[model samples]
Target chain A: MMDLQVKLPGLNLKNPVMPASGCFGFGKEYSRFYDLSLLGAVMMKAATGTERLGNPTPRVAETSSGMLNAIGLQNPGVDKIIAEEVPFLAQYDTEIIANIAGSTIEEYKEVAKKFNDAPEVKAFELNISCPNVKEGGIQFGTDPDMAKEVTTIVKRASDKPVYVKLSPNVSNIVAMAKAVEEAGADGLTMINTLTGMQIHLPSRRPLIANKTGGLSGAAIKPIAIRMIYEVREQVNLPIIGMGGIETAEDVLEFLLAGANAVAVGTANFQNPLVMPEIINELPKTLEKYGFSSVHDAIGKAVFV
Target chain B: MRKVEMKLVYARQIAEDTIEMKLEDNYITQIAEPGQFIYIALPNFTLRRPISIADVDREQKQLTILFKIFGRGTASFAAYEPGMIVDCIGPNGNGFPFDTDKMEKVLLIGGGIGVPPLYYLGKKLKSKGIEVTSILGYQTAAQVFYEEEFNQLGETIVVTDDGSYGEKGYVTDIITDSFNFDLYYSCGPTGMLRALTSKLQDKKGYISLEERMGCGVGACAACVVSTKNEQGYLKICHDGPVFPAKEVIL
Candidate 1:
């Protein structure tokens, strides 16, 4: 038997395969496909200070191997998520990773503090890199000092382990990762969607409603692995790596590239059972490297 | 509810850039309703295209879909042949509710790609001995299809934006003061649906809608439409690809 357990700062995951925020809703929609507890965790949608309907029609555009989305973070707000979505998720024995997004620093602090007493909420994945939004998203993620400030504020308000989600849009990833770690982030999630756009041929207009969207799916896997490799070398915090991770082999590659865990993003839209399928197939994939435990794969691709 | 791989029995282009394909599947044939649609998973495409179920042959255990060449997804589907297996997850979405007794004198209206699902509804109503008046609209004579199939069910009227064939006008042009209908069911573009729902105000009916969908099971919230409530949004795929005209904002 292989040991698939992963220990983050305060949470112990049964496996490393959890759906990324936005792709997996409050777990109610996916609960129909399989047992919700089958996942190591469930990253809820990016909740805001208030309810938002997001951008208008045509929020999605299909790309080569992935898709682009400018959903603009449409959520029911932090209070509703805690009062309603949290109680429903309590039935499932899974880690509830609250992905909080805000337009201001005070909004971020308020959202983080709302989960300070909730039992269903186990951790916070600060989504500072959501490329689809207009404010307090990629803006906070692109700048190191701003990233540090938001991370410091959220970490101060919450009792749970706060994992700062990093964006791949910037030039210096190591500097950003280091700054977040210095700001007291318990861990890091590498490679949020890269900014991209598409145009309609005949009409010659932007395809998505927001004109630009976040790129995610199998097309961005290589970039995610490279960023995870770079950040693991500089920061000592636990990392949750993601981007275009579709199969079990991709998860192992990210694990060996130095991610303590991995999150399946756009793949879930294609197959809702992807997380369970990957979790079930992880052992068979790990045996190829003769590793009896999951810890053996962490940072194995990087030479000491 | 289950992901089934169905063998394509036949795929033929019935009209200009319009292809209708039939697949052998029992689960969908048994549970699929008039407005319910299926999500077809293409090999290279990341997202599945949601096509409405045109007709179902329960005895033969088959499902048919009529799709236009809107993008690369449908264009690829046009190239498919018999014996090829297609991954389909469906009999999905809340289809049109056909339980109302007020539908004795039913007016069925559809435009463009939206015309197919109404064929199934027309046949279902006819089976219950209900009188159905189907109004199908298209851009031109060459674009109109399923005329004879809809005609077989009841009194079918074909209209076009341009007078290439049949009546010359939009589907909404058919709704006049003297033409009293107890109920109506429509499917079309947002503009057409908006016109139909508004012009036929105070009349109880349902309208089938379309949106850019993500996870067709209501998870992604990508295909949400504005609802007349505090929640504000309802999923087009789950809450309904089919909704009552009075309930939806559009």
Candidate 2:
């Protein structure tokens, strides 16, 4: 049997498959379908200091091979998540990565501090690049200095490892990646949703209520893979690659592209049981490729 | 939560733009309630189209969904025929709240595609022996539906914007001319809802607000509705797609 036990700097995942934040919720609804512990980890939905109502509808608009969403970081403030969601997640035998977002640095620090106190939380996936909201959304990611500052503040506030998630809607992803690394982020989650838009022809208005939204799913896989490879070349830190990963084959592609772990996002909407299916198929795909362990495939295609 | 693939047993073009689909799924029919919706998957499209459960036939293990052809996904759904199997995620969102014993006379008002949920609600209310009065609104007479089906249960009033149907005005106008009801329920366009709220401000009622949803279970907060209550925003998917008419801001 191939050893699939690959460890990041501060996070030890059983395998390299995790359900992306926002897509998986708190994992309660999905548990009714299957055991959530079968996967590597569960990233909690993005949380902010104050509870946000999110954007107005229509929030989602379908595109070719993918969809656009403007969910706007709608979460039940940090306190409720820690009290309600975290305790519930603790019941499962899986790592919990608290995905957090904030409108300002103080908000980020406060949330990180809360997660630090909760022993059930394994890591903090700092979301500095959510593209749906108007304020503090993607602003921290587009600028290297702002990204570094948010990373530094979060790192200081939490004892747990911080995985800074990056935005694909930027001029230089490598610069942004290196900035977070220098600011003391333990790992990186490259390529958050890409900025996109859709129009309603009959009404002559944007299809989504927010006018613009973050595009995710099969169409974004290529762009995400390219960015992961680019960031891997610049930073030696472990990377969590995601965006449009639906099948086991897609997971392998991200693994080969240099992601220490992979996150399945929009695919959950298509099939709630997709994560388990991908996890079950991972071993067979590794064996077929003659890789003894999942680590053997990590970044294997980057040099080639 | 079990993902059961259901075969389409029948498909009919019910009105000018509405298409009604009946699928053979026991699980869906048994648990489905009024105001809850289903996510119909069209393999050709990436995202699933959400349609409200218009009616359910438990004995036949058939659940019906009424949809209007608004986009490519819905247009494709309207074209689906019998014997075709489609993936469905079900019974989602909070359904309409009605206390049959407490409510003696109930009034159900619907406009356009918003009329589907009221059909299911009327069926349930009728089963409890509660008197159901329905007012269905359409753009024109050719677009009207459920008048006959509703008549079998209780009294039904049909209305069209133009002078082409039963009442030559809005459904709310027809409602005003009718008897005072103990409880009122409505679903429709924002303007129609606004008119209903204004007309029934002093009355007890509930309105199901439609917003674009992501996960439909309140996780994404995509379908939040602004309320006048202490809680700034309520998740339409979880807290309610159904809310008290007075609490809703718009």
Backbone collision tally, model 1: 1
Best by TM-score: 1
Q: Per-residue lDDT of B22-43 in model 1, one digit per residue for the tens?
A: 9997688888888999888898
Per-residue accuracy of model 2 over A156-254 as CA lDDT, tens digit each: 887899999999999899999999999998999977898999998989999998999999999999999999989888798899999999988898899
Residue B188's C-alpha lDDT in candidate 1?
93
Q: Residue A122 lDDT in model 1? A: 87
lDDT score of residue B58 within candidate 2: 88
Per-candidate count of clashing residue pairs (backbone under 3 Å): 1, 2
Off by over 4 Å in 2: A302-304
lDDT per residue (tens digit) for residues B46-96 in model 2? 776667888988899998878888877788788788999989887777788
Off by over 4 Å in 1: A302-304
The residue-by-residue lDDT of candidate 1 on A1-304, one tens digit each, is: 8899998886779998898999888989888888999988888989888898888768788899999888889998989899999998889888888998999999999999988778778899999999988877999999999999999999889899999999999999999999999999999998899899999999899988789988999899999999999999888999999999888999999999999999998888777778899999999999987788788899999475
- Candidate 2 scores a chain A TM-score of 0.98
